[model samples]
Target: MSVTEYRQASAFGKRREPHTVIIARGDDIRHFTIRPWLAAFVGSVLAAMAIGYLLATSYLVLRDDLLGATAARQARMQQAYEDRISMLRAQVDRITSRQILDQQLVESKVSELLARQSQLTQRHGRIGPILDRVKGEAGGLPESAPLPASKPELRAANQPVIYADSSAASFWSKRPAPSGPETAADRADRLFVAINQSLRAIESEQMDGIGTLTENAFKTADEIASALEAAGLPVDIDTDDEAVGGPLLPIDAGMIFEARVRELDEALEKLETLKAIAKEMPIHNPAPGKPVTSSFGVRRDPIIKRPAMHAGIDFRAPTGTEIKSAGAGKVIKAGWNGGYGRMVEIDHGNGLTTRYAHMSRIRVSQGDTVDTGDVVGEAGSTGRSTGPHLHYEVRRNGTAIDPLRFLKAGKAIGKLL
Candidate 1:
């Protein structure tokens, strides 16, 4: 049995009373006393303890949920970080691939340009000998002024970039990694610019060489024409003074190079034509390495001692020495002529003729085509010749001029030979 006791105090009295609680279980009883202030204090402590236990229980019951939420948030953050890294890697790969493609394209163009430069070099080699020949012929001519020193040297663009794998190397080395796409792209762009500049330089050099060749060809043609005119022969000079007419078209680097090549070809053709004309002209020495015994113009006649006009120059050669044709022509007369025994007359075209007088034997008949070095007869003291001397005459329309003029022209032509 259990019984509880409560004691009340009077309002005016100072006496304190206690409340007692009894509890019995299986014939056992327990009593507890509680004062007003003590009860209040104990009740407050118990209520505080109960509140704390409730709060702790609530936190324990919800701990898993809270922890799961925090873990989920952390997982999401890690996923976001991984995705960003993946995106960065993809961006880097794309940029690298694009850069490689651009580099390959530039290399291809450089290869083509290098091939063209090689072709130009070969053409220059072929023309070198011809230029040397022209220079030799024009030894007395004034030298051309040197080109400007400021001319840029031709650059071969085929050289590869030094830092081809710089971007890849930056990833591993201590050097700062690439900041962004702009850095890689800028490097490729710089390479392209360098190649383009090199191509332009080569093109400029080719243009200069073409110009020089054209000038040399023109000079040579003019010199040949001048020499022909000075020989008192009417030269039918062909001039290309007409203006060319065509529609204006856009020109590229390859087109410019082709145009230069065409110009060089035309110049070479004109030079060749002039060379042929000069070859056919009577400008070769009849008796090479032989001393001149008598000169043309007013001189005392060898047979008749009188101050008279000598229409031909005489060459002193040994008896029976080979006499070659001065120029390529057809022998018109090979038999005896008045005052010129054993005379050989070659009728060259353009109203020019060469006469070789005083020969021992006539080896060529009339209507025979004789080259410049072909043996026509043997030298001898025949007809007006005094003693084993040759009388050579260059006549234009049958009017004799100085044969020395034609022989002097031979000096210029000999250089080409």
Candidate 2:
């Protein structure tokens, strides 16, 4: 083939190239080389590398952002959990504080109760023996007789010798053991149980003491009555019958003693309740104002010319003098009576009754309950009285008794009249 025909075939097979290439500004030289395949391969490799780099960078940034967000969310959740935990801890602390305060208060109250119980026990400790002697005398028992002057040795030895150590020995023997180490809640429970047990023990002991005292009192009363009967005095013993105008009989010693014991028990129960309420109250005398204006016994009648049996003791006072109840009881009658003007009759259970006569004003009505030292009336001269005075009578089953004996016994018992 000719060169022209060859050139034409090559031109049709080759790709287009740049027209010129400048080497210098003034005098330029131009050269051209045909390498289309190599250029295209290089371009494709560079483009693919750029695209891969960009995609890898984007993926890395997105992964970092996602990890940071996940970490933040986890941190927030942890903080929330910690906050809840803290709140719960605070609540627990508050509850614990309150529980501690309550426990302290209870302990204080219990201590006060214990102290009051101790005081009461001490105050009433000596009353039992005195009452026993009296009861023995009242029963007319052969063994329970007063010693004659000839038997000085027996009388001297028979007298009771009071000692201070007796109560200590009893208390040490009866008190409960201290609680052992345990959780606070368990300890508190044990403490309360022990307190209750102690209270019950004290109550039981007090009741027993009261019963003994009552028995003794009855015996002494019986002995006194028997002595009076033996002395040629006209005395009678009655029970379960209302008293009339006639010479009333002496009370049944046993019944009167039992009644007194019951009354003491009831009074003790009330006192315990009061002590519980007044744990921190100040101590004071129960009877604030009291004075004995008269004594109990037979005397010449001021108005009557004939010898008469005196049923009660009279206390002279100015008109409108305040009259207080000597003990806890229920009012059975409050009004003007046949010979007792503005009288108030109180029934202390167990066949014991008290009458306040010649009162100017009655503060209590029938069926009204009154406590010891309660204002029941105003003293005045009424109903067959010579002057302004209070006629106080204590009766057992409607039988009159000597007021001096009871007053003296109450004083010996450490009672506040």
Give me the candidate number with maximum TM-score: 1
How well is each residue in 92-202 modelled by candidate 2, as lDDT tens digits?
A: 999999889888977886787667556445434434444343343333323433321111111122333222345644664686765775666655654554454454444
Backbone clash tally (model 1): 0
Task: Assess each prediction's global lDDT (C-alpha) against the native.
Answer: 0.72, 0.60
For candidate 1, the C-alpha RMSD (Å) to the true structure equals 9.8
Q: Give the TM-score of each candidate.
A: 0.66, 0.34
Q: Please write out the lDDT profile of model 1 over residues 331-354, one tens digit for every residue.
A: 999988877888999988888899
Clashing pairs in 1: none
- Candidate 1 ranges with C-alpha deviation above 4 Å: 1-201, 242-255
